[model samples]
Target: MKKKSAVLLVLSVLVIGILSYIGAFGLNVGDYRVKSFSQMLSKGLDLQGGVSVVEEIQGKADNTAIEKTIDLINLRINKLGVSETAVSKEGNNKIRIDVPGKFDKDEVINLIGKTGKLTFKDPNGGIILTGDDVKDASASISQETQKPIINLELKPAGTKKFAAATQKFLGQKITIYMDDQKITDPTVDVAITNGQAIIEGSASLEEAKNRADIIKSGALPVKLKVVQSQIVGASLGADALPKSIFAAEIAIGLIFIFMLLVYRIPGLMANIALVLFIVLVLFIFVTIKATLTLSGIAGLILTIGMAVDANVLIFERFKEELKLGKPVRSAFEAGFHRAMSSIVDSNVTTIITGCVLYALGIGQVKGFALTLVIGVITSMFTAIIVSKHLISWAINIGLINKASHFGVNLRGDNNA
Candidate 1:
């Protein structure tokens, strides 16, 4: 049993050490890659720098209308090829948009908040069809003309209306407009009852695609006015990231030293568990694709302290049991068993607080709460399971048998 425990302890330490190194420095073997936490985790607007805008509905709108407006705005932003953009409804009548990375604020605002009402009109300025009548729009190169064009698919009603307009105005120009701005004017050639048509005046395929995406996103169900806008500079985020990482490194380093000094062997086990805790939390973040913000880093640092606190409690219990002349194995078991309640109580309360913050808060606060909750739960597992098993294995291997090894001095007693 002692031999088995020694081998297991060594293997566990090796695995944890390797994981910790890889988590910090990443690994690339052939095509398979494992990114470091800094590279794997997504950064929020506050961390990466970007534009954030909030818009308010101008008039009273129902739930369905507000939801539809949000969907349309998200579609518009996505079509703009903005990755990591967040579009969510805030309050009852407001929508918040977060676009990460550097971008022109005005262009983002216009693309996201605009009421893109597309219309087809005759040369006499009479409306022939609205965006609602159009079923789909796509940008492609014309097979015959070899020019950029926007292909339009119309609804049954729009097909009839467009057929009539084309027949009546054959050889005349029919204009298409988006938000009163003219897009294309094509002369009717052969008018038929087909539901398909093409607009062909784009100078480039990129412009054609932009126009098609705008038209395809459809109009917002309700008018919205921009209420707030903020821009974060990329330089600010760039500076903050290194400082935050440095601070975390210093904090964790101090924690590792303190644990090793105060509790000796048990402290060493706790330190190993702490490293595992950090790796597990980071793994969860990467798996869930959670965005890390500045506030989120604060939460992570705070939980590191909490994770140490659990080990402190368990080690103290172990020392108490040793002073009572309990065998090393019994004392180890008693330590974890007695500390379990306190650990669960503290961690559960913290998790509840994190839940409340996540439910009530927005933006950075939400990020903080999410990180805190994940850290707390992961810390609980490390302290209760990983740390317990590590110390148990060390004790079983006869590496830890005396009370002095746990910083406990039973001078008058033979327990040592």
Candidate 2:
């Protein structure tokens, strides 16, 4: 049993060390690559730098209208080719947009908040069809011309109207406009009843896609007026990230040293568990694609302290058991059992608080609450299960039998 425990302890340590290295530096094997936590974890607007805009609906609107407006705004933002953009309804009449990474504030405001009314007009400037009549629009390469073009599919009513317009104005130019700005004017060659039409002459595929996305998004259900806009610089986020990381490293380093000095062997075991705890929290963040903000980092640091607090409680009880002259094995069991209630009470209350904050908070507060909840739960697992098993294995191997090893001095009992 001792030999097996020793072997298992060594293997666990090796596995944890490898995982820690991979988490920090990542690994590349052949064609497959494992991204580091810094790469996998997403940075929020405050962390990555971007534009934030809030727009208010000019008139009264229902929930459905507001939802549709948000959806249309999302479609418009997607055309910007920005990743991790967030468009959400704030209050009853306001919508908030967050686009991560650098972008022009006025350009984003104009694109996302535009009504995007698309119309087809005759040479006499008469409206033939509106964007509401169009069902779908996609940008693709024309098979014959080998150039980028927009394929437009119109509704049944639009098809009939377009067929009549094309027949009446055969060989004449028909113009397409978006918000009164002319997009294209093509001469009608042969027009039939088909609902499909191709708008050719785009400079590039990207330009065609942007035009299609705008037309496909149609018009917003209600008019929106920009209320506020702000741009965050990349330099600010770049500076803040390194400083936050350095602070965390220093804090964790001090924690590791303090635990080792105060609790001896058990403190060493707790520190190992703490390492696993941090890795698990980071893995969860990456897996869930949670956005990391400065406030989120703060929550993570706070939970690290709480994780150590649990270990401190358990180790204190363990020392008391050893001083009572209990055997090492029995004391290990008694220590965890005695500390279980206090640990549960404190962690459960914290979990509840995190839940409440997540429910009521917005933006950075939500990010902080989410990290807090995940950290607290993971801390519980590492402190109770991981730390317990490490200490148990150490005792089983006869590696930690003396009370002195646990920083305890008993009058009559030298070994526990």
Candidate 3:
């Protein structure tokens, strides 16, 4: 590489590192948020603070029933326009729900815990059908009115019942009730004998979709009773963020000092690559919008340590090559080549374990797994690609050329 190009490359890497840091932490320009990492990262309930509820099945329920209940709850929560909601099985007959962000505690509890129990009733208040009879429901637009509407399909038994009811109640109204609260009552103009029905008068498509989702969730296989409910305070997790950031800063500072003091020039190269690695990993997290939990911070710290270890291995190998009478450039190549296998093996294994954990684990464990996987991938790229180029550029430009500069001892005078 030419001297000018090499110089520009090094400066560019450093500038990118600084900008990445600013972006991850954030910067403000006047009244505008310039580079806000907090906005980009999705905080979990522990970090942002929200309501948590634990509900137990009211009657006989097995694992399958519990899972179905959880699924239904998930649907209801999602329909409420909340993201980053967590619904997980607690034990044999219990499920836990966590919702992030501030909300009305009572309203949220009522919304989630309500059995929904949508029922169709005649004008005389006689039951016609229940939500369980419906097979599927979705939202769409009405071709005639150009307004949002809900489409519902019934199961075979529901179809027969609804057909008979519509035939009997023609020119009359059939009321739809959710938890005994009247939702919509439309006149049966004709007999809907094809197992399909359309609900009109929705204000918007989103409202239509929400109604459909609520109706579908109302068909959950089991009833749930709230056993525990609380609004978690963010003070604990909020305080943890700064402390963890401080610790991470100290860790990086100490690692940089140790590397620079021990390996001299190569250590400086590794430190630069480490900065790039940190930036890349954080950027990836933001891109993927992975929730950053405390366990995720732990995984990040571990990955940083492992990244430094990769550099140590390569630098040691480089020193050995130098001691064997190899020149600076040759020793750099030989070091990276020799260290490649070990780095690949270790990182590959770590990634595999992370994938396994992510697949089988839940909640915080999955958070740890996600960060671990991203960290390992970025660490390898930093070690092999970023470090290699920077170190080779330094030697090529004569910025580092002496054996002493590499922390290698001179043996017999055979250095070429």
Candidate 4:
């Protein structure tokens, strides 16, 4: 049993080390990517750099209308092929948008906030159908003309209305307009009874696709004006990444030395657990696709300190048990059992604080809180589970039999 535990410990350490390396640097084969930390992790606007726009409601827009407008804009932005975009309400009357990575600023600006009003009108300017009546729209090639056309599916009511209008004016043109701009005015050759229609005027397939997407995205519930827009350069984050990593390295090196010097063998085990804790946290971040920001790094550093504090509490309890003339094996068990309360208390309080910060904070503060919460939870696991198992295996394998190895004085009471 002792040998099995010892082997398990070794294997655990090796596995953690390899996974940590992969998570940090990634691995690829030829043209295919096996694993990539960069691809797994999402970056915020501050990290990758992009455009930030704050728009104010132009008219009497309430909260519900503003929220609906934001949703419609999000659909439009996605249709424009933008990902990792953040849309949130800035205040009562303003909405803020952050798009990560570079894009055509002018094109994005026009597409994101456009009130896409799709309407089918008679030559007399009476509306026959609107965007709300369209269930779906897609760009396709016409079977007869072999030209790009937008195929549209209408709601039941729209189908009836369109069928009646086409019957009334079989030879006249029914014009389609998007945002008050004329898209197509097609003459109805026959009375159309089906729920489907086609608009053809696009110069190319891509243009037809764009027009279809714009029509499908729907119109905003309220008008919005771009009050502020600017491109964010990633230079600050690019410079900060290396420096933050260097600082973390130095901090981790110092903690390792301090733990080894102060608590000896048990501290060495704690260092290993700490390394695993950091790796596991980052792996979780990647899996959850959390965007890592500068403040998140700071939160990680703070959690490292908290992890060390937990180890210190356990080691202190272990020394206290040894001073009571207990055997090394008994001391290890008593130390962990007695220290569990304090460890749980401190970590629970810290996690609660992280939850509060995450709930109330925005942007960078939310990032900091997220890392803090994840760190605290993982720290508890590493300090209590990983460190305890490591120490127990060391003692069970007869590797640590003396109190002095645990940084405790012999006092003529050494016990195997």
Quote model 1's TM-score.
0.77
After superposition, the stretches of candidate 2 with alpha carbons farther than 4 Å from their true spots are: 116-217, 412-416
Relative to the unseen true structure, what is the C-alpha lDDT of residue 269 in candidate 1, on a scale of 0 to 100? 92
Candidate 1 Cα errors over 4 Å, as ranges: 116-217, 412-416
How many clashing residue pairs appear in each of the predictions shown? 0, 0, 0, 0
Per-residue accuracy of model 2 over 1-416 as CA lDDT, tens digit each: 88888998999888888899999999999999999999888888878899999999997999998988887888778767775787777767888999999569988998876778889999999999999889999999989989999898999999999999989999898888877667678788788469898887789998898778767767888989989999988887899989999999999999999999989988998999899999999999988878788999999999999999999999999889888888777888898899999999999999999999988877778789999999999999999999998998998887798887788887754454
Q: Compute the lDDT of residue 56 as modeled in candidate 2.
A: 90
**TM-score (all chains, Cα) for each model:** 0.77, 0.78, 0.75, 0.77
Comparing 1 and 4 on TM-score, the stronger one: 4
Question: 108-167, model 1: which lDDT tens digit per residue?
Answer: 898876668888899899999899889999999999999999998999999999999989
Greater lDDT among 1 and 4 belongs to 1
* lDDT winner, 3 or 4: 4
Which residue pairs collide, candidate 3? none
lDDT by candidate, in order shown: 0.87, 0.88, 0.83, 0.84
Candidate maximizing lDDT:
2
Residue 248, model 2: Cα distance from true site in angstroms: 0.7
Stretches of candidate 4 off by over 4 Å are: 29-32, 58-66, 103-105, 118-130, 135-154, 161-217, 413-416
Question: In candidate 2, residue 211 scores what lDDT?
Answer: 75
lDDT of 2: 0.88
Q: What lDDT, from 0 to 1, does candidate 4 have?
A: 0.84
